[model samples]
Target: MLIDAHCHLDFPDFDADREAVIERARAAGVAQFIVPGTTRRRWPAVLSLGARDDVSVCLGLHPYFMEEHAEGDIEALAQALEANPQSVAVGECGIDARFGDTLDAQWRLFDAQLRIAKARKLPVVVHCVRANDPVAKRLRQLDLPAGGLVHAFAGSPEQAGKFLDLGFVVGLGGAVTFDRAKRLQRAVQSLPDDGYVLETDSPDMPLAGHQGERNEPARVAEVCRVVAGLRGQGSEAVAANSTATARRLFRL
Candidate 1:
């Protein structure tokens, strides 16, 4: 009963055989997926896939793809969420300091989406890169009603605690499986049990040995296994707790 909590099955990467990809994940014990929308243009495809019983949808503007966002996309997102109450969360949104030029723009956009989530009483699925401090600061200030997920989190134990204190869960994925990710691995090992969630961010963050290849939800089981080993807990127990944490976070 594993859940891949941050996959992007809506992207064209799976257009040729989306159903088959899902079947493979099912075979690998992944029973559900949380597909977060990166931009408004991809919302229809995301909504289409989320219609399935096994998928949950989240809509937002990704900070990395700031260029793809339109002037009124935030308003459009609000309308979309209003029209689709079934949409569980308001994200795939957050700041990424990596993009120097769009730093200020990303903050504005991320804050706007956070406001929508706060108003709508829905959770969020955040994508952050090199900006945990500001993200935590803003979240503490905004205090969204439904706490969000810090998807694919790769930060220090202290940083993980900061986000958790601000009512967000840290998402650990394939990065934890790499030997070189000693800092991230240590953070995973020491972070409080209730402060974390499992995610794949599939079709993107591939596992250590599978670099340069297309990642899929099926590999989340492997993620669960590695994380369990790091925490010195049984894989089943780790999976159960993380799955429950996800269900709690997204109300899935």
Candidate 2:
């Protein structure tokens, strides 16, 4: 079975047919999902999804939604994690350079979540974009014991090596399915069997043929196939190794 190491199943995009979406994923052999919280307001929804035996959750503030985050939300996050023992990790949080205006606040929020992950001994589910080096640098500073995933990784083989060296595994998803993603394909080719996991970043990041459509957990199987083809390995082998790595990281 394959695990979607990072997906936002709790988002409203799936509200119309969440159960059907999940059933389809199960039918497609995608057995588990990790849904990370994006904001204080969304934590309840995220935690609700955790009630499912096959779904695990993480709590954090996403950098993309910096304006939605209020002061003291970090403390609230800490308390929420304390109260929600089922939470599997600490984020869908990290830096996104596209939003240059909020870069400073993003760092503050990302750093706070990293520290919380350190203190709680939980793995994290990061959303890095165009800032792998900076993210890696920050990660080095913390050296979190329960190293987490760099979700939807679109970095170079060298950068992937950096995260692997730091005890983290990069997540491969829809991005790698594109023919133009040659660099990412190369990174996939170079990853150790245990160095990465698959994700869909559901409700976003549609795959090659499904552009403009909503991505869902069921598509992680395709991600598995593409990654396997890139590595010249069988899909089953990729599924097994990625699943094992994800289970190890989240302790699920």
Candidate 3:
């Protein structure tokens, strides 16, 4: 069975038929799901999802929605994680250089979350985009004890190695299935057995042939197959290793 290590099932996109989506995923061999909070306001819903037997959660302020975050949200995150031991990690947090306007603010928020993850001894679920070098540098500086997962990673093999060195596993999803993604495919091939995990980033990163539609956790099985093909391994082995790596990283 596979574990979708990073997905946002709490988002409104799934509200209409959330149960059906999850059931489909389970039917497709996805045994578990990790939903990461993107903002303080959304933590309640994210935490609520975690109460399920198969769901785990993480809390943080996402870089994309800088305006949605407030001054004390970082403190609130720490408090919430303390209050809810069911939370497995501290993220959906990281730098996104796409929004150059808030680069510094993003770094500050990412830094605070990393500190919280360090002190709490929980892994992180990072959403890194176009800022891998700086993100790797910051992670090196803090040296989080529990490590983390770099969600939706599209970096080169060298960059993947850097994150692996820092006790983090790069998340591989729909992007690697495309023929044009030679770089990410190379990274996938070069990754050590435990150096990566499978994720859907549900309702966001739609797979290659399923473009223009909402992505869901069930497609992780296809992702597993694609990854297995890339690595010249069996689909079952890819699923098992990625699932084990996720469980080890998030303690799920």
Best by lDDT: 2
Give the 10-residue window scoring lowest on summed lDDT in candidate 1.
191-200
lDDT of 1 by residue, 1-252 (tens): 898999999988898988999999999999999999998899999999889999999888999998899999999999999999889899899988989999989989999999999999998888889988888998999998889999999999889888888888989898998999988888898877777788788899999999999999999999999999999999898889889998998888
Candidate 1 off by > 4 Å: none
Error of 3 at 29 (Å): 0.4
155-218: candidate 2 lDDT, tens digit per residue: 9999999999999999999999999999999999999999999999998999999999999999
What do the candidate models score in CA lDDT, each in turn? 0.90, 0.94, 0.94
What's the number of clashes in each of the models?
Answer: 0, 0, 0
TM for candidate 2 is 0.99
Model 3 worst lDDT window (10 residues): 243-252
TM-score to true structure, per model: 0.98, 0.99, 0.99
> RMSD (Cα, Å) of candidate 3?
0.6
Candidate 2 residues lying further than 4 Å off, grouped into runs, are none
Query: What RMSD does each model have against the real structure?
Result: 0.8, 0.6, 0.6
* Cα lDDT of model 3 by residue, 50-137, tens digit: 8899999988889999999998899899899999998999998999999999999998999999999999899988989998998999
